[model samples]
Target: MKISFLLHNAYGIGGTITTTFNLAQALATVGHTVEIVSVLRHRERPNFQLDPRVGLRPLVDLRQEKEHPQHLRPAKVFPAAEYRYRQYSELTDERIGACLADIDADVVVGTRPGLNVHLALQAPERVARVGQEHLTLDNHPSRLRTALRRAYRRLDVLTTVTEADAAAYRRKMRLPGVRVEALPNSVPDPALPPADGNAKLVVAAGRLVPVKRYDLLIEAFARVVAERPDWRLRIYGKGEEHDRLRALTESLGLSENVFLMGAAAPMEAEWVKGSIGAAASNFEPFGMTIVEAMRCGLPVVSTDCPYGPGEIIEDGVDGRLVPVGDAAAFGAALLELVQDDERRHRMGRSALDNARRFAPGPVVAQAERLMEEAIEARRAGRPVSQDRAPMRQILVGRGYAARDAVHATGSSALRTVRKGRR
Candidate 1:
């Protein structure tokens, strides 16, 4: 079967891009033809290495399309809401519609919400369309949420990284024809050995964006630094918040102890040098960095955020979880792990054991099953097994609110009907 992946930007080093690339490669390895369709090609070069078997195609050359000369700066001030809306409309008109009309694939999957909306509304009727939501539905703007609730009616399946996120989509959107499935991100197994000699380094890695809450990590690290003068904290990733975070570090007298290492390539090697991993995000849909750190056998200290960390980290077993946004608690948690070598080692071993659950093979197998179910439902002109009454009851029993359970069940029913027809 031929499959096409639609992504916002494939050239950058991000969790979504990496996961899409890995999944595409996994499908290709199973003798399926896979192609990546990037909406915007901003750079002449790609930062993340992609599988050679996967074909790359870019819809827009952003650099060439710009009108300003080298020294001249483009207008930076614009209404955020209006600008986003305009960009979404333009994507549908200029790229998405054209791509759908040209490509003849068995299935097409959209990797983000904007692209998901496009795939559901613009893709040809003959092809099976799937929408993958990388972030929780709660993070979406009001307008986009309404659009997705309506647009998802056209999609065959809706996938998210965690059960909590899926439940949020079901509750908030109240949409039909959506089958929310858990498809967590996977990483390549680490080649480096676990940290043997630790200089008491704690690492956090992700885009230095507001949602990541790097500021909170810095505040927490300051407390750790005051107690253990020899320990250091290293944060990797580049974004608009660099200067602000640096300023905060200086203000906190953490200029020397906290290092803003911008976007480290081969992040696994960096993870191997750390004794502990930290994820201080306010809300993380799924913390891929947590798993990456665990794969390198580093015990993690993460916030008990909305969806991911709570599900991934078995508190006090594999790692520790502090209350979200509590610098004191986070500092205390980090200090506890940092000071105890035996406890850290025990948790690191457990973390490595837990990492096996997210291996590519198992994740790919789950994806394949969803695809096959979609195809079979389309062929038979009947609802898929996912829409059965028992499943609906189970979702309700699992603590999903009443209204959400109804919406999810209805969506599953619709998906079965639409897919069964094909």
Candidate 2:
């Protein structure tokens, strides 16, 4: 079977790109030919390692392509649905549309909302179009959510990283026949040895964005520092929040202990260096790093975020979960883990065992089975149901209502979720 994945930017180092490559590599290793179609190429080479067997096809090379100077201009057709829509241009629409129209793959899965919209509208009907939701539906802007409820109707399957997000879609959207399922992101076993819970270190990694709430993490880390002065905190990744977070660490007088380790590759090695992994994000769609940390035998101390962390961490067993946005609570959890040697070691071992459920090989195999079923169903002439045509309404009185409240599909009908990602 030939499978192609549509990604926003394969060159970037992110959870989505990392998971996509893992799935592609796993599929290729299992004898299925895989191709990764990157919509935008910003670097000479991808930040993460790619399997030689998986082919890469870049739609737009933004580097130094004199022939396609239009790549430098802004996209006119890029939907307001994406927060980063301004970065795209009219050329992106043409290239993505053309690419979708021409690809001859068995399945073409999209990794983000913008690319998923293209797959819904332009992908060939014979191919199975799967829209992978890497972020929670609640995080989307109202405009984007409306567009998704409409555009995603054409997809044969919509995959969310968590069951909670899947339930949200089933409750809010009215996709009559489209199957909505939760398939967690995969994390391969680390190449390095697992952590032994002896280091006085705590690690957190992600884009340095406000949504990640690194400011809160620094605040919490300050309290942890006062209690355990010997311990160190390392935050890995580069983003716009770098300068602001650096200043915060200085203002709190933790400039020396709390170091901003910018963007480490082969992250598993970094994971194993810490006795405890930390995240204080306001929200996490999948908490991919939690699984990565767990796989390296380090128990996580994370915020019980709405969509992911609560579902990933088994509280007292494998990891500790604190109330969201509470620096005091988050700090207390980290300090408790930092001081207890025996408990930390026990949890770390349990975390490593739990992490096996998300290994790429098994995850991809399950997804491959779903794709095969979809292909067979299509060949059998089962009509893929799409959303109803749009209906506009004018409110003259005190009347406000949620869209599709009555037309929405029941959660029980859509809970055939395959497996937990973390």
Q: Pick the TM-score winner.
A: 2
| lDDT of candidates 1 onward, in order | 0.77, 0.82
lDDT of 1 by residue, 97-211 (tens): 7898878887899988767777887787667787898888887778667667777877888889887787777777766655677677777757777765365899899999998
Q: What is the lDDT, from 0 to 100, of the residue 187 in candidate 2?
A: 86
The weakest ten consecutive residues by lDDT in model 2 span 389-398
Q: How close to the true structure is residue 289 of candidate 2, measured as C-alpha lDDT?
A: 89
lDDT of 2 at 115: 83
lDDT of 2 by residue, 327-395 (tens): 999988988888899999999998897666677644664576567766766667574433321111211
Quote the lDDT for 153 in model 2. Answer: 84
TM-score of 2: 0.88
